[model samples]
Target: MNAESIAIVGAGVAGAAAAVRLAERGVAVTLYEAVHEPKPIGAGLLLQPTGQRVLAAMGLLDEALALGIRVDRLFGDTPSGRTVLDMSYRRFHPEAYGLGLQRGALMGLLWRRVRALGVPWACGAAVESFQQDGDGVTLQLAGGRTARHAALILANGSFSRLREGMRVRQSARLFPWGAVWTVLPAPAGFPQIELRQRFRSASQMLGLMPVGKAHAEDVERGINVFWSLPVASLDGWQERIGLQPLKQRMTDLFPEVEPLLAGLTEPVQLREARYADVHMARWHDGRVLAMGDCAHGMSPQLGQGANMALIDAHELSAEVGTGGTGGKDDWPEVFARYTRRRRAHLRFYEQASRGLTPMFQSDAVVAPWLRDRFFGWGGRLPYIHQQSIATLAGYKTGWLWGRLKL
Candidate 1:
């Protein structure tokens, strides 16, 4: 192992991005992954302007744009055709738009950058735990193997066991609700540039987002379809509720989605996803630093999971530039500064996601009623509308303060 190299656990978005950025700056990075072959998980996601800037900085934005659908607006309505939530990226800037992409496409882009930058990969090397020594951290990988590095970065997913030993004050709670998602060929007449959704109160919600082809050479574009359900129900959804009933219910709420749902034949077509809200008092402890979902995971209501991870990678690289003469003694300062730079931005999104999730995904009767009755009007006021758009664009750093220029 290189003595000056940083060890990044998990080759997901955050870890891979960090490795690429650090390597681009002439710093040595070793990316570790638990899986023997690293691949993207999940279905599709929206790339906010904030995340786009990070990709642009990494020189991968153009490729990402080519593989993604340009989403101009997010529109959600009730079964009775009442708009509950409507937000547009154009409201923030004339040229601003969100990119809806398959998660695999984004991962493929980052993996290519990883290879191009010559970042070392340690496959099947999951770090089970770590101990911070005097000026370095010793990682204890699975199968009793060990490796030591000058500094350690934990970018493992939200359910990472590595986070347990960090000794930082943290809390992880599984949200009661989650969604089952699948990618299907984009149906005809479906708007290619809008993320359209339908809701029947808080219990039922469905969304369709046009995600362009996974590869540039692919002939057909695709759309990501997701339906909300309680986490407990997901276990037996296939046998208990069955696909036909689910499809019937979905078509009943949003008839336009009927054509898309027709493609679903088996329950296995949809992949279930549950979310967690992770809060940490601080992101760093000694020579070990945690980033991405490992540090601060939250609900997907705001579509900021991958974006926040990308930003964390960008900021961390900016803080610990090139691993120059700073050496080992500077890592604590680097970690602290990175945490400070990210605290407000992460907090605002965490709070906002928590506050907004129940209205869209819970079983509460009054909450959805209130949302349908007032959210549209609240979204119409000039100042609120602009701020809402800013938040959606991932520019808000604080509730009333802080906006990042992209």
Candidate 2:
């Protein structure tokens, strides 16, 4: 047990970024993962300016930009060619743009940074539980292995079992709707700088975003395509309705996507993703602190999950480095300040995601009707238009206040 060391459980985006940030600050960090060989999960994601700043600070932005496509706008329309939401990054800033990248590419960059910094990574070391006191925290691993650290960070995920024992007020409710997504080769003549989506009421929605490439060795570019489905319908979907029906429904709405769907033969080609709306009264309890999805998971309507996690890593590392010496005594203050700094930003996004999800994905018949009828007009308003772009850029801290300067 190293009295000056900190233990972080989970090696996903948040955990890995935290390790890299903390280690770069001259802090001793040990990252633990449950999998023997860890790899990035999910298909693709959009990296906003908030996340890109963190990557730039870590010296990985150039490589990330090279592996991703610059998205200038997000455009969504209905089957009848009625525009619902069309927000452009240029409205926020002339040079502002979102980076669409494969999840694996981002993870690879972070993992390489972790190894380069000599951070000790414990593969297959799952921390099942922990007990914290005034002195320090003791972590219990799966194989009866126990270790001590000055403090503990729970970055496992939104579905973390360890968070249940944390004595904090929290709730994790699984959303009824989820998505099945995959990355495929981009179709010819597809808009390279736009994220295009089509909706058939609130029941059926499809999105196609250009993600440059998964690997550098690949010759062709790629596109990430996803379809919204009820979580209850995911199990035995292939057996019950088959992929053709799903394909037919999507093509009927957006025929241009047929070329991209041609290669998806098996259900296994698409991965099922279930979301949860997580709310915590606070982010820390004594020596244990939660960050990333574990602390405040919400719907992906705003596409801020990875960006917020990266910001979490940046903020936590900054606070810990300046708040106190690398000791157990000062961690409480460090955690408190970190929570305060992130409270407004996290709350705004959580509330916004919750309020907007049903408009795009639900069983309700009228919600989508109203969304289609008014959303485009509202987006055209002067004040609402700028604020909408700000929110999409991951800069809004509250519904009416706070904007990140980037």
**CA lDDT, every prediction?**
0.88, 0.88
lDDT of 2 by residue, 253-318 (tens): 899989889878888898888888999988988878898998888877888999999999998887
**Model 2 misplacement above 4 A:** 324-329
Q: Give all TM-scores, in the order shown.
A: 0.97, 0.97
For model 1 the TM-score comes to 0.97
Q: Estimate candidate 2's alpha-carbon lDDT, on a 0 to 1 scale.
A: 0.88
